[model samples]
Target: MTTASEPRTSTGVPLPPAATDQPPAPPGPAAPPQGPPAGTAAGTAPGTAPLRALLGYARPHRAVLLGTLLVVLVASASGLVQPLVAQHVLATLGSGGSVVGPIVLLGVLVVLGAGLTGLQSWWQQRTSERVVRQVRRDLVFRLIRLRVPELDSRPPGDLIARVTSDSTLLQSAATEGLVLVANGALSVVGAVVLMGVVNLELLAVTLGVMVVVGVVIMLVLPRIREAVARGQQSVGAVGAALDRTLGAARTVKANGAELRETGTAGDAIESSYQAGLLAARYVAMVKILSGVSIQAAFLSVLGVGGALVASGHLTAPALIAFLLYVFYLASPIGSLIAGAGMLQQGLGAVGRIEQVKQMAVEEDVDDASPVAVRTHSTAPAVEFDDVQFSYAGRAQALRGVTYTVGGGTQTALVGLSGAGKTTMFALLQRFYEPTAGQIRIGGVDIATLPRSEVRRRIAYVEQESPVMAGTIEDNLRYSSIGATDEDIAEALRVTRLDALIERLPDGLRTQVGTRGVQLSGGERQRLAIARALLRKPEVLLLDEATAQLDARNEQALRDAVDQAGRRCTVILIAHRLSTVTAADQIVVLEHGRVRALGTHQELVDNDELYRELAASQMLVGEDGDPVEDLAPVS
Candidate 1:
């Protein structure tokens, strides 16, 4: 429910042009807050505990990860010995002794290291895939179970981006990203220790250069994380733009708004690109610094070691091994830099994924906790005890609305659009809770019962009559999956859809196009009614069920409702006053308040609002006859 004063968009006779044929433009979807996006429910801000959450995703795969890391460790250790072995070969040559033993050992180390590295690569990737799969599955499960209000508050496209794009980021960041950082640190430490053993003066020169460069790079990495977060949000906005436009594709086309929508989506795309460039700028700087750090250290070591060897403090072979170690240090520095960047990006992704995880989801209520709902059939007389409700950030939709609907009777709610008509049904279904007041069903307060339990006893068909993408049988069986074929036929008969189904070549198996675009407006309305009837609910609430039907089908539907009313509570909302004249009770609402309550004739005689509505439809006039004998207009 949007606003009490806003009328529903209606399709009727063309209005007299206000200077031209153009009609006043309808409103658009309300924009959600841009900060952190509206999709995330209440939780800690984006930066909190992202690293811990990333570690948690890989915790279950630690054993496999440990095994893979051991293989890489062996490979790295063998590579570390290559330079030392070369020094031995050089010494043996200088002594004029056999070098066969040293040469064979070097060849063996090379083969072993290569083999282990290959095996580790494959094993680590397999584990990474498993981690990604679990994260995606968990996200999907939690997203589907989120409470109604959370879903109502967010854009679906943005939420979907978390499951898809964010999880993909986690794929490497949680697994290989950690491996890179750990292995790089170990390799760097090993190379530094050997460099110290070979020559302390050279090691001092290398350490000084490394420490300064490391500090500079650390400061810039966090900026990458911030840029990535902004980029993810822009991408989500792009998705939202496309989703909004595609949902109303026909409306956009009818208004010739292709260019306008194209610009909207293009703008979002441009924002994403700009954000990507910022992150890229930071990332490129880190890579350049990593390379520069190694080159600077090598130059200092070369200059220092040359003087040491010339002064007879360092041997020629030792200087060569020390130089080899400095060059070997390059690989570890590069990996360390890459790993840190990946971790920062992963943390950014985790921020989005964690927001999804924190969003509140509906929990199943215990059937026998503090209150027990009766399983046996009872007249579910609905009573609204001064019900007052309001949407978030909006004025009251229903204000102190109170009424009692007798069980097993036909009651109609008559009001102009947004007079709290649809809101009444939403409250009954527990889609949104009432702000103040109580709703009782069968002398028991409904709030004490579980939402699923409350909904099980009632069925509702909305005015638009939305349809799903599937065959007729699939949609009919959506609410009651266990319903039998015979039950479906009976429901179709009641809503006067049996004949239409029979006319189709596929009968019950006929495919309904997306949102049931394959069916006419009247046919879709009837199909929704049929689907609701199959539930055999204790209470049936229809919102303009007959609005799209022809005279004959509308009368047939009313007859079916009249029959069902004898066995169950039937309440309906109707803008056309003629259809509700035969109702056992009529509640007239105006501006979120009940204006009058009585039989249709009584209201016509006494209530000005009800009388005006009736007169507008020509249902009653100065000397108009009673409405019961007249056929209802669809």
Candidate 2:
């Protein structure tokens, strides 16, 4: 629906992490066993899901992960030699060893470090891409398995954000952040030990300063996790708003509500901005606190070493070497802070990701279960016995509404808008299990049948008859994936669209555009009928297929319906009596119950409602008799 003329809103937020020592606990209900769970609180504690989950994906690539880790560890340990070597050169120069040798050694170390760093980057990124691909695969598979009803209430943009933005964050954290945490921890420990080897007094001063930094970090980190989680949520909200506004861009322009939609989207963007700023503020605080602590620790070491050297208790060479090791601690310490922040952000993302994952997906029916056949030699029937349903409470959409479609017949369902014609379809699809009911497709209860098998036995043409973005040929092939080209042609021909298709340059190959926008109302309905025809289903459910068509279009649809009735059980919901006059049986519905059931002639003669509908159609003659112009029943 979006176009260049539509008012666009900004929803992007810079993805950033807070530098802290700890992350908050994971919140919300547990994710379903595959990914993160649904209903889990927004923010999650550090390590709640476990690095082990990463290993679960990594298990297949253990050799690669282990090899990559070894190389990275070697590179990190090798890089550690730089400061010590520089200190050694300083001492050698003080004792007058040739400057060329030390300078050449330093150059060698730099080249080696650069080469190792490059290798580490390549390996980590490769492993990360593989792991992310696996996660995305699992996520997509699980998403598809979720029932349609669950998706109906969710925002398309939010789902996109999870797969694209949220997943990317997790990938970065796994590869880069994990490496930093591991190497940084090693560097800190190694430096500490090296410092102890050089001078206990200096090491003690460094440890004391680190303790202060740790305490400050603990106080600041939890807030950062909360802010990061909220910021991401705000971004998702903004994306959702923008998605909605853009989806209805044509409607907005037609109504001159561009400004109003933009304002609504803008509100979402503003909330994202505020959340980003809040997270940034906390990240800045952590950065400042860590920087100040590192600086103080340096000054304290310098001061103590200066006094020791002046008092002749510490050698000039030893003090310089010890100080160099202390400086080495800085890089790892800074990395640790950065890694902590990434950890917090990753945890937040996991919590959000799990929200969808935790929802219970519909279980697959056993392949051996009995199939629900909708057609029998005796009767073409659709029946509901003791049906009961509720979405969230006792407010039932359908309650014990029972009916039947006689054999080789067409049944028209009539009622007020909410009288539950649609609810009947929902039950037929098994989208949600009934609280209690037996829906017999023919003589067999649908619940006892395998879900897929039951669905395969029936053909559903929805109200809108939605068509995808593919070509007309592709659309027809959707109902029966293994159908041949001739099968598709036959379906098109049967629906009376073959002549129309031949007029277009590309015919069946013509793109339908998104949701089949290029086609008229009649064309879309015919396309749906063509799709259903390909399946050669035993039972057909047409929901208001002709409600919105013009006269010509309605006649075309009527022809198609007539063709369908020859070989299948047809159940239709239509407001027009003309569409049902030829039907073998017409069931009148009101307030979720059948009020009348008979052939068109029989109903007109016996039922007051049927007589009123027929009389109002202007088909009745002057003498209060049925008109001679009435179309003959098929």
Candidate 3:
């Protein structure tokens, strides 16, 4: 058992202390507690670091982004011309001249501006989608390659939310944020210059008022970033809660915990609601500030410019044009404020994405790497030499376990629960390395080979017989991609699954419900075995494959195992002594140590623990008489 103080794997499984020769553990998922609260200042929180990283995602599509920006600039410039055209008409009327020329020009400018705005929007949206696709692709690539330990420590729903909801926020930030900042700045500067041309005194008044209000708005802008960051965190929490309940839907239903699960989900939803309210409060404040500043600038420009016009220092047409510019300031100022908010939210999301990217990933090997071939003529197919392993400060799970299974022979591992039968297979599969020991396959140390190469040479059927949600053929061919129809049919026949397949309405194409709910426990076990057989691996590891089977199926599976044993090395774990009675050898384990190694009869006669276990299942009587009714204790 693992101790409380022990370090755990990413999946919460306790790990043994690292050997001196072993590398350090990989970095785990970023903790949620490190995120900023709703009231924290955005400048001092996530800051520009995340924004810079987000820009890297847009680098490859810079040409499209630049084109989009050019369109936005053209649209803004066209809009600026409208105000000038209007001024020309007003001046022409004041001078008692024809207004037809100015009116026609104004109409042309409006049409051109509207068309450019539509084009800009389409291009921006397309670019945003491309950025989103790239971000999600990188996230998924990192997720699949992340070390197993790191994967164990994180919630699946939270990761999914990062890819879906968080990436969407980045979409808006990447395109809209860039365009707003660029176009809004240009519009503001152009408006100021036009106002100065009308009257410098009025221009000064407008700038003075705007400067004061802009500072106040800038101070409040950071608060929106903090609120949005917290809101996104709450959204991730909601996703995690939903995943927890839905993933185990049957368990919740079976236990009549509907109300309890609903309550759990409700709490998460409430948190998200509260966070959203906080974000909205900040956003509303930003809008109010922007509106107030624009109104103040308009009043200032009108009062100052009217006085200049009365003094004969400014013309009526010029005053009217200056007022128009004051009104036009609203568009760009509003865009600037909104863009800042979007960028802040994007920064928050990028922070989370960056955290995932920083996680340590396992080494990826080439899929075309050569598979290990069995070449040894006299060496044992599998050998464990003084293997020792512990689960993070706990007693050893496997202690000095030394054993060998000859090539092309069957070996039975007979042990009680927690006696390290499964751990042995884990070691062989290289899921966890022994603290001190050597494991070999075909006389070659497995540690010297790539993980993929080792796994390619062996096929494992777990005790639970897990199946994916797909057709019968999908699950069967999952391991062996190149398996032909004839090979699959032969495997089914060998595992006695031909009858089950024939009964199905669609035969090999029949869909298996989630977790193989459509199949019986016995049928699922046989299917798992058949799937392994189809791989044609050099070594086959079966972890209690017949544990769920009926007597007839168990006998048929045993015959199938016997047939497989003739072609490849077979290692099996069985609790029932009768199952291993005719095995080539039986290795009895107790408390992480090998207690005896001999034939079934030899163990029954020499090992007390074996006899007691055999008696409990009625495989043998206390008086040393064999039970007559038990058919291999199936």
Candidate 4:
């Protein structure tokens, strides 16, 4: 193994000193702060900003929302008529008149109220679903378009939570919260007015009690919003933890670390449970407070109204009607408080969702029109001029390095593992931009072009030969959707994968399983090569493409490389020197700079580092073992 102190490649290039003191940063996006922002703190109410933003999401469905509001009003009116009908019945009985007509009217009002309530509920639910669906769709679109750096910082599970759970909160808040709050406020106002007409003293007493209770609820409301926000964050943490474990399920199982993984996931799950408990505690407090306020108001009304009735200041029927209105106040008051709570929860979710929306997103590209490859080119196809790059929390990976690879020629890049070989490939594909300097493709500065256009002309096959979970044919056609069956067959034949297909029971339809576990390493590598070939790109990048192949498969890969070189510029990185001996040119890199550039024969004769590599393998002894060391070059 290469150690930090004495980093050396097979080609004898020395690596930079390692900063082993600091642990390397994990790959992917930078992680955000552990907690929500200060604006989402526990003391803060679900403010106008969140509510206003939420309304923006609901704007598209405003027409439906308006209709639902009308339905709610009709329902509220039906509910109000029942109490008056009861009052009429009580008055008729007191006057010694027939009560049958008033009693029948009361029953009819009850039926009408029930029917209207159900219809209102149906419309409200439908509107909520539509709003949620649209919110989720918009979130998804923004998530996918986020810039690479932003994406790297966020966990996949947390993002999924935003799309699923966070959006669900908006559903309840948009329809139920808005509609209930509206109808409840209207009913409360109506009740207050009717109660005043019956008895002003009783109405004043009830309002006084409600005012005190409302103040208490307002104090507790902000706390509920805070707890709910934390709960949702905890839920996101659970999702992120599960995603981490499942994505590497095989590795955990193989290492017998299942218990450890489960423990880690359990911690996240426990956290979510605790947060939920906190939110529930606050919600319960709100419910108890609302109930107590209503009970207190009822007792006060009954005591005061009874004295007035006995004193003959109020009639028995008016007292009864006033008591009914006092009871009516309970429904709307409870509903209003509940709706407020739901709105607070949704506002918390909105904060999280809005954070994602505010992140930087990549510019849209016109994939319909790609940069056309030059049919006739005498100039170099790829060039790097004084390029430099540094990844986060690390020393520079590439120094001021410059080189040119001619069109339709095979150039092999040989370097130490940390000598920026992979970094070079990344720059070529514009997966990252150089911190300094320029890169040109086909005599055009790639910086001036869209990422999509730059990538359109090049085909890159990574060293790992990653395969998606799909059938053989699906993986093959991934890069080239328009590729014909004959085109696929030709690529398979060139990469010598035709025989594997013939032997499989399902031929091209054979499933590769997850990450192509069903295929051997060599087969996966060749499959990647075949996929790239089908693109017919102007430039082909093979990063240790034949690393897993045996001697026979390696030879077949060499043939494929030669054939590919005839039509496109081929640049490959390889550790095995023998495989690249026939390359048109070899560029050796050391410490992120070009150490030597020449053909196999020329480098072996003159370059000491090249000679050492050749002696390690090709320059064998008479006993068929490699020589220990060759004489130093003069």
Candidate 5:
């Protein structure tokens, strides 16, 4: 919603980072072990219910995840079988029985468990890739569909970060975290149960040690979740910084601000580094707790089991089996801790991703009937009926502006900067909604029509003449996908781009580098005009279309436009009095209001502002001499 009168930065600031070095954004609430869908559980966006958001992603891939979980369970069961087989081998040897059968069974179980572990690895990795892909796709769709106002509200860099870095965090969380929590819990239960059957005295001592560590772990987990959330926020900040700096690269270099700009990005990068350290610190704490719990329990069980064996309370094979179960118990506990950490990290990303999803997108009706094309005729082809409008949180850009242009005629808007001329074009294009009043095309209210339907009948060339990254032909057919080669040549010939196209080695296929930097300003302007003309729209809106052209090219384009004006309604905003002097009608805008409505000759005679602008452009003076013959005015 930035107007020509205001610098774009004046209208809106870039989105701020949620966390900084000094004060971090607090982590969201702890996630449920079995989270629900992101939007359903909280009836809100993803970040607030991050666990649910994660589950929502996994939900779509539930069959794959369940498959992965099953493999993990089978692998854990294979592992659990090893300790029992080893105990049998010991018992057989002690009984002086044939030990070969037990020994061979133990070796076979070891190989099967290894093979399942490898299979589980493949499943987890594959499932993680799929989850990340879906997350990125969802983010990309939301980003592209975001309304202009939403785009204006945030930096493009931070939005991109959601697709890149943030989505990556969700990959493992959806798959690995699921396997760890589910299989680990089951494995831990199975190991504890088997250990209890072998010796209750050893099991009791081990459980007591684990309870102390578990309580301590619960107390510290919330901090890890908070740290991870802040870390991801800082990474987003880094992206925002780079985007801002790189977008204005020329300006930064022109101002000799390379160091300063780099420092700005560096500051964000440093913040991310600090956050990374904080997250790692919390993760290390969890690992230490998990590792310490195992060691403590092992030592306590070993000492107690040894004493029991001495007292004949526990047999040798039973103590050996109980101890083996204690060591096996460590693997699942570590998995649970790792899974919890990954879930915390994924939850951190949910808030930023959800923030983007919450923004409103432009509504387009897919089933609405296409608007009928209007042919040449004398009627009010376009009308602004007491139209009132304003930018978000800004003063009115248009104030009860009322006017009408006849079909098959050209109407020019002549105004000083900030007089609402461009804003009129924006309103016509449905980029913004009017606060009050109606704008009609061919006597039909545009508001009642779908935005896409309305745009299909009108062609607009903006003042900036933006060119996207692509080949020349690619940009030409962008608006009208069905435009033929003959239509392209005709449009180019009209805008005087045909000669340039012919001179190029690649002709129409020439590459226009990023933002069309490979082309001159006038060439880009002509290219924009040609693209619009190719649409052959019912109504054409041009904003300073000839601003960059030399007199000869401008005159050629003017004649071309004049010829086309015979078959369609054309509304153009121009600061150059010469561009609109011969128009069928001219609307004078001043301070968001229509100050005058007349032909250029009529205005020069009747309105002082019109006369001044005409004189400034050397189109007219009091004596009305040709521009070159005119004497200098004080």
Candidate 6:
């Protein structure tokens, strides 16, 4: 529970205005980060690993994918027959030959084409939806299981983007995009084969042009992938910035910093825009080159075939057929370029998705030493021995900090902010392991027990006492899922939140609003306590639980603690001497080390820092004893 004295953001609001209204302005012209484009390696030869990974997603829907392929092939074959029919009809009309059979064949081809098109559409949508669903489920499950520390470093908006935007891209790529690529590839192959049948020499010229185009496409494709990946990263960066700004929206408006925050967001958007343009530029260039190359190849075939016809080595009908085959070649050549471009885009998305998957997940516990936690009726005891911890940085938050509290005893940790009090509780919860020493609960080393077991036995009500974005009942139920409404009422009664709930329109089911904005600080703190009480843990850890309350709320919180402590151990972290005076033991930490350990009165009389602190607060009486207002340990 927080006291009125607790620190809050200078600007108080959940999200900034720019996030909800306008996105940030575009970034200035800055080059994207240099890296190998997605699906391509820098300084390394090409490999099949990327294709194998992509194919894995398709494996589950193999039957539908196969069906799609068959439909595409049938559709392509039917389409090929049209060009043949057209040439036959044209040659017949030109030379006064029969055209009835060609027209009938063309009609049959049209009907077959329609049927295959319908089948392809169904399979494309169904298979895409299924794969997208699988990806979303996997990503969500992976995110939920990610350890707290890793999650702490990421922004929620960017993570949400992965679940939403990234998955959508994959869906498009798998469905309509995949169908086009496959069909286009088949059409190219069929056209090449038909060209060879009509005239082998002209077919050889077409192949040479295709080879050159392929080489150019290979060279251009990596650029597209690199640009696309940069674009995605820029989008994520924009999201992170917007999330931060919105999370502090009130502060920005209150402080008149909206313009500044908007500028920041705008810069991020510009970066993404620029990256998109870069990718688009390369795509345009590749399209132009392929178009010119295909036209050149067609003209070359016409020239070569004309010379052969002039030499009396080729028939007019045959030459016309060869030209028709060459015209068919244009579709595949365009498809090849488009496919390369799309392949790059998909690879870029995969790279982003893989970044999340690669993070180390929380360690799984072994089943052999199963830990079963049952809170005893008596107060829970806790012990720490030479614990040392650093918060990612080099400076230590706790060092050689040792303390103990027995069952039925009340202990308080008092120090300035960053004096290791919060770090001690973090160690007990195993949010971060100590670089040295050990912490134990009821004689069992905390690290030895499974995380779930350790946390189940300790009820923690932090200073902020985060009230999640849900209904009051939903947030309270987190402590004990099986808790009935009656049990919830009882816990709320114990923490003095029943009155607050009764006043709410929906009582227990009332929406607390995001981060409990609907509730006052004290109310939020009381709700946290109610949650803890419902769990009925053996040990209760309160970090500045009463630091944010007014006098009346503080008294209410103190009384709730007294009532609950009758059944469990209470370890409180406080900066107020009045709060600590009631503790059976007070542990004073200075610069990450325990400097004094005793009751408030004893420490005030002996320890220099403790004495100075007590006097500064004027907590001493005329007789040099702790003042009555200080509320000595009960």
lDDT digits (tens) for residues 30-81 of candidate 2: 1111122321332333355534443354566667656766776676666567
Candidate 4 ranges beyond 4 A from true positions: 1-48, 98-101, 366-380, 601-634
Stretch of 10 with least lDDT, candidate 4: 1-10
RMSD to the hidden true structure, all candidates: 6.4, 9.3, 5.2, 6.9, 6.8, 7.3
Instruction: Tell me the tens digit of each residue's lDDT in model 6 across 1-634.
Output: 2223121221121111111111112222232222234334333233354444456667788788878988878887887777778878988899898889899989999999899889888888888899889988988877776654445445655666667766776676655566677878878888888878778998898788778877887898888877877777777667777777776677779999888878877887998899999999999999888888778788988899899899998877788877777776676667666766776676666666655665435454323322224656576689998887655433666778788888867888877665777767867877656777878888888877766778778889988788998999898888777788898888887777888877888987899887888888888988888888888778889988876677777787788888777878899988777776778899988888999999877887788888877766778754457565664321
Point out where model 5 deviates above 4 Å: 1-48, 365-380, 622-628, 631-634
Candidates 1 and 4 compared: the better one by lDDT is: 1
Off by over 4 Å in 1: 1-42, 45-48, 365-374, 622-634
Task: Give the per-residue lDDT digits (tens) of candidate 1, residues 1-634.
Answer: 3333211111111212121111112213333213343222235444457887889999999998888878878898898999999999999999999999999999999999999999999988999899999999998887886655566555677778878887887888888888888888999999989988888889999999999999999999988888887788777777777778887889899999999988877887888799899999999999999889989998898898889989999999999998889888888778778888888888887887877766656565322422222353754788999988766545677789999999888889988766888778877877667878889888878877767788877888888899898999988887777788898888898888889888999998899998898999999988888888777778889988889988888888888888777767899998887688899899998778888899998988898888878877778774445555554443
Each model's lDDT comes to 0.79, 0.68, 0.77, 0.77, 0.77, 0.73
- Reference-based TM-score, model 2: 0.85
Error of 6 at 593 (Å): 1.7
State candidate 4's TM-score.
Answer: 0.87
lDDT of 5 by residue, 177-263 (tens): 878988888899988888877877788999999999999887777676667666666666667667766766777799998888677
Q: Among all windows of ten consecutive residues in candidate 3, which has the lowest summed lDDT?
A: 20-29
What digit string (tens of lDDT, one per residue) describes model 3 on residues 318-371? Answer: 888878888888998888888888877777677777766655464544356333
For candidate 1, the clash count comes to: 0
Error of 3 at 584 (Å): 3.6
